[model samples]
Structures are given as C-alpha cells and as structure tokens.
Target chain A: MAKRLQRASETVFAPEDPEFQIAPMVDVLLVILLFFVSITSAETIKARPQSLRVLELPVAKDSKKKETSAGEVVINAGWEDGSGMLEVAEVSTSKFADPDRMRQFLRDAVKADPSLRALIRADRKVEYGFINQIMLVCTQEGISNITFAVVDKERQG
Target chain B: MAGGGGGGGEEGDYGFQIAPMVDIMFVLILFFMTAAMMKVSENELGIKAAGTPTASQEAQPAEIQLRIDADGTVSFNDRVIGSPIDDSLAALRSRLKEAIDLFGEKQPVVIIPQSTVKHERVIEVLNACAAANVKNLTFGGGS
Candidate 1:
C-alpha cells in the first residue's frame, strides 16, 4: 500500500541533500548569546564599588536573611576627611562626586517601579552624613523602603 | 603570504566551522556564570524612611527620640546609656523593649545621628530598635 501511494504522486521532487545544518546551529548560538548577555548585565548592575566590596560591614543582632527581591537599587558609599563619595549601581561620576545623578536615577527607577527599594552598603568607618544623603535621596524619590547590609553580630570575626 | 596572512589557500573548503565557535562561546558563558554566583550574600536590616510630616495642632502622641553623637555616645530621651566600647548595646535594647511594652510598637521612634558619627555606631542603635520590634522607625536631624 505504501508503494502504491508513492506511485500515485505525479509530482517530481528534488533529491534530499545530506549536509551540516547551519540554520539550527545559528539559532542555538543566538539563544546562548541572549542568555549570557542578560545574565551578565544583571550582575553588572548589582556589582558594588571597591570600597564596599572589601569594607567591614557593621554588625547587627537583628539583621534578617531576607531573599533579595527585584526592584532593588544598591547604593555604595564611603566617607573620609569631611568628604564623601556616592556610587549607585556601581557608577561614579568624574565630576565633584555628587548625588545629583543618583537622585535622577532613583527618580526614574521609582517611576518605573513604585516598589523600588534602596539597599545601602557603606563602610563601618563612614560617617552618618553620607548615609543620610542616600536616605534623603530615597525619600525624596518616594522610595520609603530602605535596607542596610550588616554582618551577624554572632559571627563577629 | 608566507605568514599565511590572507593567503586564502589553506583549508578554504571549510567556510566556517560552527562547532569550534560554539565550544568557545560555551566556555565564556560558564566563566561569567561562575563569577556572578561568587558574590557573597549579605544579611539586611530595613527601615521605612519617610519624610517628616507637618505638625498638627491637635493633641499628638508621644515620640521617642534616640540621638547618636560623633564620639559614639547614644542618648535615649536626653539620658545617656550604653557604652559604645561594647559591641552589644544591651542596656539600650532593654530600655527600648520596655518603651515598646508601654507605648506599643506603633509608637514613633526617631534616630538622630550626628554628622561625624561613624556608621557602625549608628547601626548599633538601629540594632537595638530592631530587637525591640519598633514598627514606626524614622531618621531625623541631629536636633
């Protein structure tokens, strides 16, 4: 019956060519590229500055192990000699080191996501003056949820 | 041409091998994934930092004020307690717990840290507030 069905077709078709499938390979490559591009960008946005990367975080007995959620903007700060520097999402400006850029970023972020929260990671030796600047910026942008990163007091080493 | 620069005569039959390119891309992706995962996770303590509200003429509730000085001294309601030398602010914690018991967790608590105060000292005060389960927490000026 299969031979009769094949014989019934009057159309003549081209012969099947055996070769490497480049189209599927290209699709796989594109998918892989997209995956890494997205992942690396997210990690880069969450990256901290050098000061916050190595500084000793303050110890707290009540710090909770909350799973980090989306819509969080990390602000890294450091202060010395009556001056301070601010880095939002690992970006620091060459000009006078002001929070104007950070303020604008926060405003836009809050507009995009009303649930945006600020996660401040500052050095232990940094002065409150700097941290307050970050808090003021957050409040001004209508982001009332402020989180501070700290080490567990029991793990003081 | 001796250096095989644009000679176009060696293995020209194979236009481009996707196999080797794919291998290299996979390795690069693995490297970046590991680097991103290496970032250490940190514990977080949060506060709802809102703007100061305008004063009302109606009868108002009592507010608890905690002040931190530049020299690491912490004052609760104008009375100094807890030595900054100790890591654990046990005294301040107990007093804050007592205040919560009386005024309830909804009572407003303001933390005022001086300009030059170290962040570590300020966090100590916040630690005490967290232990006492203070719900209405805010940051205020160093008045």
Candidate 2:
C-alpha cells in the first residue's frame, strides 16, 4: 500500500541538498545581546560617596564621674602633628605607641570603675584603621561597654 | 562539522560550521564571570584577625564587639555612648580610662568592621583605645 501511495505522489518535491545557515543563528544571538545590555544598564543605583555624621550621646544618670590621678589619655584625630595620641584630661598619653602599655592603662581604668564604658569620638577625616586600633585596646582590656559620638546632621550643616 | 577558514583550498566544502554558537558561549562565560566578581567584592572587610584567641591575663574570656559604620561612628555591642567627636575626645578618654580599670585583666577585644566602612574611621577608634591605654588588638569581618 505504501509503495502505491509513493508512486501516486511522485509530483511531490523535497530539497536534496540542504545545509545549516549561519545568518539565522546570528539573528538569534543579536536578540540575546540586546536583552542583556538593556537589563544590566537599566539599573539606576550606583555606589556613591558616603557622608558620615557623628552624633552626641545622652549622659547616664547613675554613672558617676571619676577623676583620673594617673594623668590624661589623649586620643585626638585630625591633628597636624600626625601623632594619633589622645589626651586624657589634660595630660598627653602615648599608650598607642606600645601595645603593652596601652593594655596596662586599660586594665587600670577598669579596676578604678567596675562599671566603665568607653565613648569614642572620631574626626571625619580619621580612617577605619585608626578606629580598629582603639577596638583592639578595648577587646584586650575586656572593656565591653563602648559608644560612638556623632554630630547631628541638622546641626552641622 | 568542519571545513573553510583554510584559504578555501583543503576541502571544497563551503558549508562550514556556523561561528554563532561559539560567540554565544563566550558571552555566557563573560556574564557568569562578572556576577562572581561582584559577589566577592561586596564584603571585602580588611580583617587582620579571623579566629578566636584567649588572652594571657584574663581567666574568663571577655567579648568586645566593635561596630563601625561608613561614617566615623563606633559602637561597642549595641549602645551609642560618647560626646561630640572633636571636643569629646577627652570625654572618651576618661570613659576608657575607667573601663580599663574595671577589666583589671588582659583579654582579647575583637574589632569587627563593615565592608564599606572607611579606613580613617577605624584609625580614630584605635587612637581612642590607645588614649584609654587599652591594648591587645584583633580584627574580624563586618556585618
């Protein structure tokens, strides 16, 4: 029966030499390229310069004000001297120079006040590396209570 | 599957494989590479210390968690304690002076900073610690 049908449809034609064309593939690729470019470029949020403002913290009512007799520790930033020394009260402290001395001073402060917390105020120009140094001292001395002082943006222009 | 690109001499087959498939593969590879690079660069915390360490002096290990934002704000644990940055350096100094006295022993304080946090801010924190005479420093990655 199949042979009879084939003989009856002898007028039908098919391509004897067919090959793949590169043009169609190129068209498909162009579509994909356009899709990607449009999607990636459509994103609007680019990383921008961060503006950091340091604010002031409220004073604790129960915390007592203890006077320092071993002189002051100065942790001043943005000084022209380039020395990252903090003045404790009025005395210049150089505990930053040596890790051991710094640790000793921290230990002493903790001994003086069992409920002691450190409040660090950094200048706008001071880098993170400098801040890490202070964190190191706190962790080493076991002074867990820490606070940062920032200026209110509304007040600082 | 093969032919052409040989000065049209070796084989009489002009019907060579299409180069479009190769171009698509290259594009896909490029896309994946970019995505991977972005992920790695997102949390680039300059943590000098990673693991945990026991201090020589403290019998009980104390945890000192330092929080650093992009601005110059530093927080220990969750509390925000301090005065205005410029004038309050002394106030900070006095606070640390007291804290150091309370700890009374050597313990490792861990500094965990954020990825986008600035370098100068970290330095100021360290300077404040030094002013308080607290030492023994270690670093960890930021949140």
Residue range A50-119, candidate 1, lDDT tens digits? 5433556788868787576577887777665567766665355332346666777787788999998888
- Candidate 2 residue-wise lDDT, B67-110, digit = tens: 66655466666555442254245554565567678774353456
lDDT of 1 by residue, B10-126 (tens): 666545545556667677667767654554446778888857454555543588888887788888888988666856788888988988898786677889989888899998888
Worst 10 residues of 2 chain B by lDDT: B39-48
Model 2 chain A poorest 10 in a row by lDDT:
A55-64
**Which one is best on TM-score?**
1
lDDT per residue, candidate 2, A1-157, as tens digits?
Answer: 9998887677465445677676776677667666655655543331211222221222221222333313223233332234343323222332233334456667787787755555554454444455556656765676654544332221222
- Candidate 1, clashing residue pairs? none
**Which ranges in model 2 have alpha carbons more than 4 Å from their true place?**
A1-157, B1-58, B82-88
> How close is each model in CA RMSD to the real structure?
11.2, 20.2
| DockQ for candidate 1 | 0.32
DockQ of each: 0.32, 0.06
Per-model lDDT: 0.74, 0.47
